[model samples]
Target: RKGGAEMTQREFKDMPSRIARLPRDKRGFPIPKFVGAVDKKGEPDFRLVSHDHMAACVRRNLCWICGDVMGTRKAFALGPMCCINRVSSEPPSHYECAVFAAKACPFLSNPNAKRRQRDLPEAGEVAGIMIERNPGVTAIWVTRFYSLMQVSNGVLFFVGEPEGLEFYARGRAATRAEIKASIASGIPHLEEVAKRDGRGAMSELKRMRKRFDALLADRVPA
Candidate 1:
């Protein structure tokens, strides 16, 4: 009986790791680290989701942005993208955070920065950054799981699937409209940053405004 129990324990321990290896929807990108909870010291760790945390977040239905427990299973999966490539690998944030991030994130707001190629010295445009959602993604996946171990330094180490195996889809058109409105409302904040950071920030905002205007122009019935 003891041997059987030990075998069961081993299987249980291995179950999540096994499930973590399963394939996920590649169309949905991983959650970005910036969307995670800050540490006790108020610093963002920028760590990817472990299988354990993924399971915890799903089981608890926590909001990635506010670290608050959510009341419902339905949540928004926000993908921070530079053109087709995903830039973040965290988890599902609150609907509000998704809208705020889409509008306020510097990478998303600034067309040049979104498309800038870090690999090249000249910093040329490579892609446009945006928050994208596929109309097809309708649910979150939580079949996979992970385990956690706390080390001596008080840091928790995620042992499996830190890149995340679960996914969420972007919100609806109303949500997109809210994001655009938030961006428009944030213009003052951009100007404040320019005031504090000087020419660099000013130039960046100018470029973003130009890009935003161009985007608006493209949407017109021309």
Candidate 2:
């Protein structure tokens, strides 16, 4: 955020309400509360998440995007892989904030968008298995039950069963065809994991497939 300009109220009016509440970074992008560290030159890196900030969100029921108090139902704007596993590396946020992020973030909104490969130790160490690739499809997974589960050196949020589910691709509601395409594109990674983890993992994959199909069956729900 070193060179970032202060966002004006006028600019806020041009953006979504929840998004306008966020402070902008040097790149003119709204800085999410979940962002934790900066690059070597002290520029904030959107890719990194701060564990302290994450914990605070869970402890206070604060929205990760806007850093505001949240309602009882917390929403997670997650990638397709996270949807299947019900694991989020970040905390929950207000529905509007999460949806705005799901649509506005280049990495989440664009299937063709690629994550930059970088090593920023200042961002701190992360726990659990990381999926370096973007999930392509974003799911607004909503629930009232979620808990922080500490991993070896970091933490993760284990989302309870979704009370509401919706899918987005390229910023708008995703069609069943699009969801299926996303699943097809992403399932290979799961298959590879199952191949390495063996029969038990394979069984889980079968169940995951069922879940995936069930979501597709609804196709964003009327």
Candidate 3:
């Protein structure tokens, strides 16, 4: 049988390094520091910095606009192009800042919105939607919205995040407000978001693989 100290070491090793390190912000909540000994167990303790004690530390570090935990935020090239400098109690990624800025942007504003639909799913809803829709759909992509590409059918449909409709489905009929209202009464479209994120990441991975393969082919054997 393993000794107590040995078992503790094994458990600590199994924990994620990121989680173990404990996340913190530069401006709002600084990351925890390794403090001096707490007890005589020969184990170390840490004191984490906090901002809003009312909410969870992770929640405090979430995207202010979408409430997504920073660890789980999605990346977008458009983030820097769409953002303006703003101060917040929490530290947010560039993409998160850009998203918040987009809300006020002329292109994303309510009055300036080109689409007729509204009400988008939360991140959790996006995850679930992706799992459920995976069987019925061929593939999914995350552009400005969740796109469902038909399997073996070559058709594409939008499930959530109606913003992309104006750009991708030009001249398409607008979604009815009643439908938005109906979805609002229930769960937000989480799976839809997940599908889009997953596919987008996959596409990026494929591109990376191709680049690596090309580089390998050019290498001269010694």
Off by over 4 Å in 3: 1-72, 75-93, 115-222
List lDDT for all candidates, in order: 0.36, 0.78, 0.27
lDDT of 2 by residue, 1-222 (tens): 346965443233235576686677766788887788777887778878876777788778888888888888999987777788778888888887878777778799898898776685634445677666766688999899987788876788889878888888888887777776777777788788888999999999889778866875664653
- Pick by TM-score: 1 or 3, better one: 1
Residue-level error in angstroms, candidate 1, position 99: 1.2
Better of 1 and 3 by lDDT: 1
Query: How many backbone clashes are present in model 2?
Result: 2
RMSD of 1: 18.0
RMSD of 2: 3.8
Report the lDDT of model 1 for residue 87.
19
TM-score of each: 0.28, 0.85, 0.16
- Give the top-scoring candidate (TM-score): 2
Q: Put down candidate 3 lDDT per residue, 1-222, tens digits, no spaces.
A: 366443222122222233334443322221222222222343332222122431342334443223345554322212110111111122333242333233322223232234212232121121111212111100111133223333341222322321211110111211334222322332223323435779875565446445433432343121
lDDT of 2: 0.78
Q: Distance from true position, residue 112, model 2, in Å?
A: 1.4
Candidate 3 matches the true fold with a TM-score of 0.16
